[model samples]
Target: MYQSKYPQNFPENFLWGGATAANQIEGAWNLDGKGLTTAEVVAKAENRKKMSMDAVNEAVLATAIADQTAINYPKRRGIDFYHHYAEDIKLFAEMGFKVFRFSIAWARIFPNGDDQHPNEAGLKFYDQVLDELEKYQIEPLITLSHYEMPLALTKKYNGWADRRTIAAFTNYTKTVFKRYGKRVKYWLTFNEINTGTWGFHATGALDQDSTKNEQLQLRYQALHHQLIASALATKQLHQLCPMSKMGCMLARMQTYPATPNPVDVQAAQVADQKNLFFTDVQARGEYPNFMNRYFAEHGIKITMHPTDQQILAANPVDFVSFSYYMTTVTQANQDGTAVGNMATGGRNPYLQESAWGWQIDPIGLRITLNEMWDRYQKPLFVVENGLGALDKLVNGKIHDIYRINYLRQHIQQMKEAISDGVHLMGYTMWGPIDLISFSTSEMSKRYGFIYVDQDDQGNGSLRRIRKDSFYWYQKVIDSNGENLI
Candidate 1:
């Protein structure tokens, strides 16, 4: 059993805030010269099990792009944050948010991946968003790309699988860096860049008809391109902003052995290495030997430019940020699998699960923090951590005590990690306002302090109501993690 620790306090300059992705929050997909994106074609699914790359393949994408009115793509109509950002930001300010992490939709800015110039209207939208954050004196941590790449890129160059996408991505990054470099001090090159290891959705690479081995090759190649692009962007940001910091984002999947057996421990160690490889390359400026051996054994080859290693070595990320929703168990010969956000592993009998069957292990977070800090020796930021629950509104008020308990426990573990000599930078909950769920495309699996009036079918007045966790989090921020009662 885990023992509770006292003196649970956060750093005086610790950043307390919330995070949202453009593809999951900002609607008006085609407005203000915005072009279609990979996210816009993702049709609504009943649950994560029903969601697959089949809905995002070349044929389906062509059909959706040709006739946008045919299917009700939920992501295309997020929480309508394009029209409600100001109102939502006001609510965040009311919650005493010290920072706000959001992404700039690449398709919105470039319209097409190969565009020579950025869309002024897209830039203007973020300008207004920054202005609102500035009004509240809230720091902005912006993600340059967050799964919503231009659909044209996937069509034209097969997304990041081709080297041309690297040039296109760098162009987009340079544009944003030159425009908002002075205003925004913190930036992330990509959202969960490690997701490319398992799925093509994160990279926007369409390979629906390829063999299993072929798909694996493409995924790794695209990941390499993204790493190079991230490095190039980091280099340019250093040149343009000089005072700003660039971070790499990963979906941290902390793995534990289901039993004390040596095989189970070894399996867990390998699983952990897979999850940590992204940060290793980004923070340490080189690929770990384990990954190189794994790739060779798996017959995966990565094509790289002569200068790629130099660029990556010369420009590593300034900090490491990741989303930690839950932990997974690894058993050497177990058939039981546990579901989670962007990860799956053997089920552990000890941990409780969420509504979506995601195992909740708050202690895993502290362990992950200590391991990451000890390994990278870099400032670590918890960019996305929250519990997704089905919130109900009664009398126009949401009493989400479960959400409060979830956050409180996790925040306590974070404090424990801070006490464990971790150089923690900040903690930004998954979201401040309820938005579309990324995996299931359901609005019901909500993780927010402020609830949005919408449903799975996307019908509601779109009213924002503060849940019970809203007030609780407000106190947490105001007291800087000291008043958890």
Candidate 2:
């Protein structure tokens, strides 16, 4: 059995759970009147390459959007979650999960960006899922959008650059709130909204052929519009579901200075500011002055309506939720070799890395919780945090002790954060069951307590098998996070 050192500090109401995104896990991409989605092409696995950001921005995105086909999308056939949600939810219940964080695919509900009515079949699918969770007494923390906007919106409106998308998204939110708001009391407006900065391909929000300057301008403009949309959603959520909590999700990545030099230290702060930029607006209800200077410095002008500013200032999210994967190091000079560093990277020497090169930073989780709680003074939810690695199926069993170690250290830090006076609502590691990778789009890069029988080439029986970590996690949750080995 596992035991926490600070058992009294782990709040009784603290949520012990896991998370999944609709686009990453739900396989019925075109089934039941569901239209095509941005994720089908842009976040498709075959489209990814381990290369520099310049190559990705200039080539990979253009090629993916220009030539992507539905068949190449592994997410289209994800572990067959659409057909096996009951079986999967049963596994989650067995683990004593209190909550499950997932997103409602905008394409599923709206079909296209602008639809007169929601498809009943689409809504029915979620109704069944929510009923299953309710049966288990597990709460649902729903994210309104998680990288699968309708392809029609991306093609016609350039995602969110045109103001018309704001109306379309608002319409979608209103429909879902009316349908499932009572069942799901917690909501996040977007999944890892900060990812839109560099991973615009995933969001389908950028035009491929635009010049560098036009790219940044369009990118921030889209972000500005999303900031507006999230605020509006918060207002709508409060009015329709007075008992629910609404939050904005961010990808929280911490970067330390590569060297002790003052310039490198200052550069690290700048990089951190870039990551916090999204929350600064949503939580504060207005863009910070630093963002204004950033926009001017980059020659990016965000055209906002008079009411847009008021909408933001008047409606701040009720809470803040974020995902912490790993922390990289920042340096004064940009390393052209780094793939996805926010500003730039000089690899961290203190930490060990996953097979995918993401550093293992358990302490960073505690730092993130404390900083976010101090910054927002609202409840914080650690929505997603886990390690993805190669798993070996040995005689019908998986020994993923690396994943167990990764989660155990992080949970210990989480208890420390609770003792530090952070008003944390819950903790949900990234997909509790195996699903396609959001970054590499490969099922081989697995991060799940329950392993799904699948591979990179999309070959497997779609079977679920409990790993050693699954039982370990069950014990931790059964003890209300009091147990951690």
Candidate 2: worst-modelled 10 consecutive residues by lDDT: 47-56
* TM-score (all chains, Cα) for each model: 0.96, 0.94
Instruction: State in Å the error of residue 2, model 1.
Output: 26
Q: Which runs in model 2 stand beyond 4 Å of their true positions? A: 1-8, 43-70, 336-344
TM-score of 1: 0.96
Residue lDDT tens for model 2, 1-485: 34465344788888999999987788888799987776766444343334121234335545655653545567777777889999999999999999999888888888887899998888999999999999999999999888788978876877777788989999999999999988889999988888776645444575556787888888788888889999999999999999998999998978788789999899888888889988989999888777777788889999999899899999999999999988778878766445233324666778887777677889989988888888889889999999888899999999999999999999999988988878889999988999988776788878999999888777879899999999999999988887888
What is the clash tally of candidate 2?
0
Candidate 1's residue-wise lDDT over 69-162, tens digit each?
A: 5136788889999999999999999999999999999988999977988999999999999999999999999998888899898888888888
- Cα lDDT of candidate 2 equals 0.83
